[model samples]
Target: MATTWYAPYVAKASGWLSDAVNLADMAQGSTVNLAVTGLSRSGKTVFITSLIHNILSAVHNPNRMPLLNVVASNRLMGTWLEDAGANRLPRFRYQDNIEAMAAGAPLWPAGTDDLREIGIEMRFQPATAPGKLLSEISGTPATITIRIVDYPGEWLLDLPLLAQSYAEWSRATLRLYRRGIRAEAASEFLSFMGQHRHDEPASDEVAKQAHDLYRAFLIKARDAYGLSHLQPGRFLCPGTLADAPFLWFAPIDVPDNTHLAPNTLGALMQERYDTYKREVVARFYEDHFRWFSRQIVLVDVLRALLAGREAFEDQRLALESILQSFRYGSGSLFSKLLWGPHIDRVLFAATKADHVPDVQRDHLAELLRSMAAFPAIEAKSSSARFDVMPIASVISTVEDTQEIDGQRVQVVVGRPVGSDKQAKFFVGTVPIRPPRPDTWNAPFLNVPVFEPPVIDSSPVDGVAHINLDRALEFLVGDRLR
Candidate 1:
């Protein structure tokens, strides 16, 4: 009976120990957050869906050999499943897209402002013993939560404003509208800037008008810029003035003294740009971006390069600007904020590589490396992850071959809307590694085969199954693990 008394104490101690173990497990299994950003029409949505699909496929498979093999080989833990906030991550939903898929039509994404958070649970099956396999597949399951924020790419431009002043932002915006390869509508905003500059000692109404004018111009440029996927969040809306007047600066104009009222249009534009950059973009970066552990920056490298030299240079400068914005360098104030944490890994992808022949895939990676231009890191240990891989989101499904004299060439065919389809040879080579400066001189197409599509379905003459799986691997592979 005396020895039995110790049993109660042991049970009490074990209860507390169990609670402690649960807490530790939670701390170790903290949720992983990822941000996916790319240019409009890049395969972001498809990639995310494919990643989820593959993970689900692996989880639900009755034949547990792959899981067993991975576990036995130490590639993974046991497998299980959880609700990846199935109802929450609306952006990843494929049900709405089935109509477009079934019809063999190009799919447009849902509007941007209405982005939804998606949560999925990744079930982890713990390994059997140190060596032995309990079962080829595990009957038990453990889970980790994955949270993702799906926003339209247009919103990505707002991230860099934290560092810029309104004047600087205005000058920069004006320069881009004037010298950049944007649509002509952007010029109208400049006229407003010119007028506001002549009004001395500007009144609040003048400043507000300039702010509204600048926003209107941005909206017009976005609409007319031939990039139709512009409506993400209404952050660009002219009148959400919670902290509105702060963004009421004007663009700076060169000195052309004609009966001046102080605070000219140039001044007004500069101030508004500064406020927008600082208050708006900075706030977004602070609120939405802090939790990201990984990020993928999708770019249209080939498209920009193909637009010829000036366009290429503009894109190059834009890339540099973007990279500098994200980097946690000495002068980067955002990085110093509680919300501005250093990104663990960043993957810069060249999208729609499938549009070109396989032979030139490596060249895309090389192009990306050249474009990245070696970000200035806080430390060498502060990793700057980058890659250039071809992804055909909406695949061109034709195996186009043509006879050039005596030689036969397999090509990819591209078509403008309502235009005749033209063929470009498929470069079978896939990208093998990240590009570097030295790689730039080499042929862009010679890299190793990254991943090729399996071609699950038939093409609609010119349409094909894009290498979306490869994109998924590049984007969420590590996260899946």
Candidate 2:
């Protein structure tokens, strides 16, 4: 029986099993690849920068947090910065553009259109038996290596489209935007597709008007819908075809009603979209990812809910879709059969908790639990896993909220991007978090000058507890053995 093999089964598990009949080969120093992905400008880079700082700066003197305690309590478990071999790890320095983000200007992140890699090296010290034979290492540190990489979140959107075809994608795309929340863009796209229904236009008299109109519609749709995922950079590429077919076809309300000319704009765009699904998305699924020991999915839950209920519901559906895409051996599975072990645990992190006080962070976690269908537990499950914790990295306290008399206003405070003199308008409440079980509210109605701790290029005031350490343990804890 020749079955259609999704990437996860064929590329990940199949290859892994063939290489390791006894599974001892599977035990070769476990590699943990943690991906921080979401929509564009969603603070991924900043979060990653902050995470590195915490891990490098965290000391073992205090066992207050469970993460360091796990390392400290175990005599055999030790950690350190690793040698990069010929490729040395870069200094844990801040991105020069971060200051701009801290100010008011939004960042478009460096490698959205292209693929880039950032690696960090960590030297590990494994625990040894106290009274063992000659080879037993005791009271001495051992060395192992770990690496972390950062990539563009927009690439993740393609994971779902891999299973779709040109006609299926055309229909689904039209249906998604037509009646869905982003309808205006759909209507405009469909109108553009209506233009080149018959013969392909001749070169000298190519129907550029329709193309220009469609591009304008895409721009407007992007602005209206906050679609940072749209690859406008590709549209503006230099050369002849740049002005041709792709610029003309828009998302259609009724693609079935429109006639697609064999050599016209509609045909070209439909082809490109399909090509993107197969070449970029499917290729990545087959070759790039391996099922890991653990996964951390960062979600900006509050921002989604505040965007409005429709956006809120849409986000919830998107979360479900994303989880479905990661299922092992499914039609949408991403790993190959010979890949690494299946992910045993998934950590759903509610990010940006610093905006609120510490007391209410739990509420954010609770809110996430309410939104998702499967909090945990799925088919083809791996070992020991459960949902736990809501965390705020790079914690900080707000100094003041700009207001006049009783009227609230934002002033332009000097940040990274703008040349304004006044602080931006703000809903005043210094970020503060109390101990657990206390609800999130403005606890400090009268406190003045709440300052955050000093850490070079840190995103928030103080370092939140257990964020980086716990991430390390989850990603590489088993590898030491």
Top candidate, metric TM-score: 1
Candidate 2 at 105: error in angstroms?
14
Residue 263, candidate 1: how far off, in angstroms?
Answer: 7.6
Tell me the whole-model lDDT of each prediction, alpha carbons only: 0.49, 0.45
Query: TM-score for each prediction?
Result: 0.66, 0.64
Model 1 reaches what TM-score against the true structure? 0.66
Q: Cα lDDT of model 2 overall?
A: 0.45
Give the per-residue lDDT digits (tens) of candidate 1, residues 240-312.
3434566665455544333333465545545555556666566566666666766777676665544344445
Give the residue spans of candidate 1 off by over 4 A.
Answer: 1-29, 58-92, 103-106, 111-115, 126-140, 153-156, 180-185, 198-250, 254-275, 336-340, 375-379, 404-407, 414-481
Off by over 4 Å in 2: 1-30, 60-66, 70-140, 185-190, 194-261, 291-293, 329-342, 376-389, 398-454, 457-466
Cand. 1 Cα-lDDT: 0.49
lDDT of 1 at 365: 64
